[model samples]
Target: MQLLGPAQENLTPRGMKARGALAVMGTSVNMQIGRPRLQDLLFSERDQEQGAASIRQLLREIRIALGPHRDAVVTGPGWVGLDGQIVALDMAGRAGADGRRPEFAADLDIADPEFEDWLRDARSHYEDQADDQLAAGIADDGTPALILQAPMSGDLQAAVTAAMILQEAASRVGDVLPLHVVHGDPGIGKISLGIELGALANRSGNDIVILFAARLRSDGRLLWSRRFVLPAEDSAAHLRRVAGGVTVAILHGVEALREVVTDPRLRRMPLQDVFSYSAVRLRRADEQLAQIDPNGDRAVILALRSYIRHTMLLERLAKNPQEEEEMASDMAARARELSPGNPTALGVNAMVAAWKGQSETAFDMARHAIAIDDENPIARLAYSSALTGMGHHREAEAEASAAHMSALSELGPAAWVLRRAIAATRIGDLRSAERYFATTHGYAPENRPALRFLSAIRYELGDEQGAQAALQKLKKLEPDFTLELMASDAYPVDSLRRAGLLKITRSGLI
Candidate 1:
């Protein structure tokens, strides 16, 4: 994954709007910052207006811009939440107690000692309320008043306050540059939140530019495509050149940009930090894959097959959302078609099928994959999972053993360990199941199956607290999950395994 950078003067604005903002010195300015996506600019100012004419124009322009993808574009602003609920912020500032626009007393000074205390109290109140609602798995209709920065306007009071804090710092000490560092676990929408904060700063009359490192060309221009290319120089050089303005650079994968933090020149740059973790899931599989191969270029498929397989493993852990499945299917098909008879692609197919409960299809594909590459660890794991799901515990155990014997020094796939645990559980070897479940959890701590099986095994072994701890993680990861959800699925359909699951359910493992 690469960082995405800002587009310089490559294309003309398809359109422009005159935005008015009050300047810091009490004067008015007519100016606007460029949005990363050109299309978002079309409707960026709608919330501040009160006429149907603008909305109608937005629709007409969208029709022209989308040409072939209009239906998907015209869909409402709502997004699917982690719980599969349609969620959209109330952008009109027209609902709930928190909907009221935040205000500061006219006499308050930025240097006042009480200012920090007041800001902390206010932020804590809002954040705690949002946290409570999330923890309780509250329905969308019943959720507490929350403060999410509007995607269009980026006018959340918190974001505004954050910008003010930066401005104060910049003024207090010369060259105390305002660099905000927003970091989070993989799929928690860090980029969007950072952009929103950047938008707030721009609207506050700061010359802020948002860019993605992944899009930066060798000549320091941003390429307006999904393709990623390594920069000719470190991204910090590009940032230093834009020293006159505030810059919000989106780093798609933090690891890929380690130089920014490790290199002496960049490491010394002053930065305000923001980190968030949902304690739920990894980043979205599509976003992750896009970072890996955003443009779908055909030439590097085989060269990147290992990375693709690693992403595929993440897809399985993420429950294989439709977009992920479609992307995986297309990539898997290409991997196979481009390199026919390759064991890796066949193994990937079998794994995908196994996740979708296509047991027989998975079994057949795994057999074919293994026949072509018996020593391939992925094929061995796929065969093991398929065999377990098909009620061949003995055969599955043998396959898992083979995979273990040939496994790399690094931990093998969690799915492989999971299959072994399932076989052990089925064969009434609870001790062995417990050990493998522990290994599975070590390999993929957030994996639901590993957590679930570990919980059940702990309960059976009389480690009630350990079981409860695992269950709590499950609760946080999948709030609506119940023990009944584990009943005799195609993945583990043996009568013995079904009984074991039923007993675990009765034991209140959920």
Candidate 2:
């Protein structure tokens, strides 16, 4: 199972094929594979008789490699399997001490197309397995823990309602934020924070007030306390409305705690550091994260690095696009490897993939991320970008709208609105495109691309003065951007052409 060392170069064609066959079987179901399948994978270039003969010869070579443990390769009537009881695969060794999974069969240079196909799939399979193992090995490493205190009253209905409210609020806050909410008693060692909920009746007794209080568990320092009044006969809709207000308060409290808390685990400074627009800050954040967790097994940290690289590419901060793309790709791949069930990591991976122009990969990753967390604005934005790239303009617009609506921050909505505007233009909805572009510009007035598209859309819509104003703003931000540059094959020329701006410019409309 471990076939990636320097000695692999000494492997003869037969020895290489033998190791390849073992790799195929090892990654298959129950460590077993059908003989016909193995032959097809390893010797598809040969005729049936030649392929069967090659499989037999390869098996014999494997037996010789095994020596005294030759019987570990158990051959049935039409299938080959490894005896799990006798031959234990050291998956950890295959993963390496540093936890990076080496390329499967890296030394095998078989010319058969079928074998190459199988090798690619086998590599992906083992890579996921290695990622899971490595992720499991990573400790919590001082992650802050939140414990929900039980209600003092014996009224189960009130407790359930209060818990539902807290849960709904937390969902609104989303997992993209670095906050861990755990439901447990104080006995759970060193709980960083504690939340308690209680219900009180209004003086008129026609309404109930739900009190939410959070405090530091370490020294019982009060952090946040608020009360939400609900109707005595509150409906599900009403409760959700209350939860929305509560979500804002909770976020504000969390931000305040992050600002004052000195504990690295409580503050989550690395994650906070990544939100800045400066490349220097992002690089420093990445270095600090690596120092905090040297193993590089934290999927979120890797995903953040990928996000940083992609952001650098977008902001024109990266001096070399090719190098930034490679770094983003590597960080995304590693993050996806270590993140089995995490939607944020998957969303970041999807965003990076879309930025790299791997439309199909971006579509799949974004879909999986959305399936895991439909409300994730990043995932939705990524999906919209992929759809737009594939010319599914209407679908892209819908997803982009959803992303914009659900986005918590101005940046998220700005990106989503820009995509929506682009998709609208592709679909020939000029008015909607203009509106979306204006919204994007409003969110980030310094956004040069939004300004460019907004100007183009207004001009196409015959709003010459409006277009001129937008163009003036764009010129202020990017002096090189002009009607001549827009007509040329420079950045976003295709987009301008799609908006009919290039044609208008050629018509002497300025």
Candidate 3:
């Protein structure tokens, strides 16, 4: 079921390759995935309160698979799939630890007896892995971190790459941004991208929060919600704190954006004026800036920035030309002869540059998007994410948080939380992470990123017992899972820790 592209069956996207030892952690780790179990997991909230055996099995499987891979750079697309695998491996790892302690009760599964049976085995296994010096849980002796991926899909792509959205949302960010939400169709992987970007932001030294708008009540309703807040300007300066947890925002589906940005009172601005008629005129002018060579991605990025912003402005000023940016008729006449630029198509160009890690160029284009229309959330998020990518984390986080707050959209909130949480983890504040996770869980209980992140915090705090329990819980939620797939390179994983953030002593395996 792949797309028809490049005319080669075996050809894969150059960026889509696997290497290193990566770990993926999911949210619930439930069993019997797909349809039937989905019904139980999605609708049977009350029944889930009691726990289920399906989840236990899911955890066991992930453990069995990854328990063998020890230490390596594992990459993958989303944490939901990856967490399923971690739960499995954690179960296997913990089994050995609990085998010795038959009397110690864990914090999870207060009422369930079946979980009790699985707990003994899972705990023992985790203890063994912890001591092995070959796991993400262990001190940096080459053990990889338990990477919990967020969900991913085409529909959610905007949240990951849109520049305008990130900026506007970031502007509203604060020390206690309570919510960050990504609203869109399922399967687009918006949730996954938002969380990952946030984590990346956090790594750069920022505080964040996350909550998903995803609702259990209905499929067509808001699908994701998140909440978070960055530390204030004067947080005692462990490192002269600069940015919010999230620096940018990316969102797709213009219609969805309107739906997600809930507050009518606050301004739901775009990064640029892509929808206004005046923007069309600017876009036509920017078209002249398009590059003829691929020597660098910058040219394309700039061109795209103009397209997105202009298109956004045009959309906003649909009713009248003079009332808006006013580049409409004049630009339209020129466009009639030379044709206007394709904003959406150009925007994709900027994403390509960002993916290649050309943050400077990405930021430039993203800013261009914002310049077109300061109120565009996509441009805001895109610009902020780019800034963070360029190492301007504080600036990016601030931009992302503002967009989320004013836009009142789920994506904005999610971005804010992720950034803040990552910042907390990088600084070794496990307790703070736990608190953030609690908030995000309240919004989207099945969010794999939050669950896996919590697991990492638990491990860092020496809560091996708690970590094992969380992994097992995830197993019950998604059954058809594997650690190998979750850890693949389908997701965004920064290889090798940033130089200053961690002190590393290379072990036998990378």
Best by lDDT: 2
Q: What would the per-residue lDDT of candidate 2 be over residues 348-375, giving only the tens digit for each residue?
A: 7877877766778888888898887665
TM-score of each: 0.40, 0.59, 0.30
Write model 3 residue lDDT over 227-268, tens digit each, in one string: 433332422331111222222222332223335434232222
- What lDDT is obtained when candidate 1 is compared to the true structure? 0.42
Estimate the TM-score for candidate 2: 0.59
lDDT of 1 by residue, 1-510 (tens): 011112111111132221110001011011112222212323343343432345345445533543443332222232100111211121111112222223222222333233345435634654555433323322122111111222222434323333343332222111111123322111111121111121222233332323212211111122121211112234233332221122222212222232322322222111111001112212332333234344554322321332243343442432555666566666766766765575656777777777667899989988998897565545677788788778888888877865665422122356567767877887778899889888877776666666777777788788888888887887776676666655545333343356455456676644
lDDT ranking from best candidate downward? 2, 1, 3
Better of 1 and 2 by lDDT: 2
Off by over 4 Å in 2: 1-144, 151-154, 164-174, 185-210, 216-252, 262-294, 407-411, 475-495, 503-510
By lDDT, is 2 or 3 better? 2
Which model, 1 or 3, shows the larger TM-score? 1
TM-score of 1: 0.40
- Can you rank all candidates by TM-score, best first? 2, 1, 3
